[model samples]
Target: MTSARDIVPISARLLERLEALGTPRDRVLAHAGLAATTALSTEQFFAFWRAVEEVSPRRDLGLVVGAEASERGYSVASAAALHAADLAGALHTLARYKRLTCPEVVELEVARGEAHVRFHWVLATSEVPRLLVDSTFASFTSLARRGTAGAVAPLRIELARAAGDAALLRERLGCPVAFGAPVDRITFAERALAARFVTADAEAFSRVVPGLEAELVGRSRTRSLRDEVRLVIARKMSSGARPSVDQVARGMHVSARTLQRRLGEERTSYQEQLDAVRRTSARRLLANTDLDPIDIAFLLGFEEPNSFVRAFRGWERTTPTRWRARVARG
Candidate 1:
């Protein structure tokens, strides 16, 4: 029952996971009109996934990428989950705040001495992409493994996608992988739920949960014109995709002229918002990650590294490498 208004954007942390796997984060973000800093709506994220599926040669791209990702990619919810007393508490936290990550429904059902953690995509589309399901289950497994310090293992992994490379999933997860199921779900032993997290800190949860809850509340509120446009531009810029004014205007459900007029009233333009998002995102990536300048340029929607360099120079009066070094020094 997730609505467009309630759909959450893909987090920069999750996007970084794909970046680490050499998935050309820039193209993905650009196609979705998203920046690394912008959270993508479910529909926008789906478009990015379609773009990924179209280009990736491996049919198991989602599974492969998801397994290698770390809990750092889970963002604030991961922080809250990890602060819990045990795996059950962590799973519950994720299920409750699942909307913060995406529009998918997360359900934890306990029965017959087992816990079934099901992920359901409530899309209105004709069909759900297999890659999305694969990625979600794989990422969920990876996070669970990390949260429980490698002690937890899925009893079984089930997917709605047709069976493909089941052995690979089995090997990777150390559990049976079955497809063509009624839903996408992972089953774990009831005892696993009681297993304490290695990094557990109830006090930390007390301090962090309120802020995350508050953010969820705030996001559910209204967004400004600039905010909406910036998000669209960030998604579109992912893979060197230059978003057009008309495209953005259509996305916001308004005509181009009206969109432009409103932006003027807010003292900004489409290009200005795009530039600000890219610059801010580039600076963040440079300061926070070890990704090379070339990759950073690609993520910023530049056709070539030199273009990004030129733009960065214009913004910061120095090259990306030099700026990163400067950031490191301070």
Candidate 2:
């Protein structure tokens, strides 16, 4: 139902939930008439939800899955929101990261004493499934409650879908529900934006923001030669070894000569790419984590502490420890 170029990554959690609930993944895939793949496309995602509706007995499955999501470990995207200063910051982070990782857009607007949150799907040609709408709103309400200590509630909910059982949604969400609206939205008192998240952690948010920024840049285009090589080098580093050109080429399914030629065309080479990544990553680790230089050295695939120190000194014109201290002083 999708081209190889379309790598949509939505609702794997829902798929996993369905599998856990005795609906076999193979059966679901078979029902959707989709091929086994690492990720789903937009069409496949809708099909997956339809499959869930057909197989699962629970009529309100979306709310159940979405409401339970935040209680577990926070996703990288959600982790950003959880560590935000307040409800407004969290919503902003959520919207920013969602746009980075998916075609879905979540926006926040405050005017006339109401803070309005809305969702728009770039790829949706048909009506978004009711299950998904329910799940998304439930997830938002649940996230708000968890972050704000249940201090805020939605004033009203507006769905773009054709009219449904408004009373049922209102009862579950504890808010007035209206259907056939211009956009799928939730309204809250504008003052609710200032409610502090009990879970907020400034340091954690700072640490995650860099990675999210990198993702935001990377997601805007297809992976370049440098990015692909970086991926290989990172994987090799994780295994506690430096990656070689031949190995990197192998990882990328290209011959060494071909990889070199391509890099030349791009005006960069593998070693330069590796050095840039290590410098950036070393700083991030030093600034964010409690890992010692020796540990960070190994994590970055340096053979020994001396090697990492020499490299860091070359990059910063100072020792890693002093650089970290100076950064801390600031």
Best candidate according to TM-score? 2
Clashes of each: 24, 0
- The 10 consecutive residues of candidate 2 with the worst lDDT sum are 2-11
For residue 119, what is the lDDT in candidate 1?
A: 64
Model 1, backbone clash pairs (residues 3+ apart or across chains), number: 24
Best by lDDT: 2
Distance from true position, residue 175, model 1, in Å? 0.7
* CA lDDT of each prediction against the hidden true structure: 0.71, 0.75
**On residues 151-238, what C-alpha lDDT tens digit does candidate 1 reach at each position?**
9989998765545778877877679987654345799998999988887887888888887788779765744577678666655653
> TM per model?
0.59, 0.63
| Residue pairs in collision within model 2 | none
Rate residue 153 of model 2 by lDDT. Answer: 87
For model 2 the local lDDT of residue 107 reads: 65
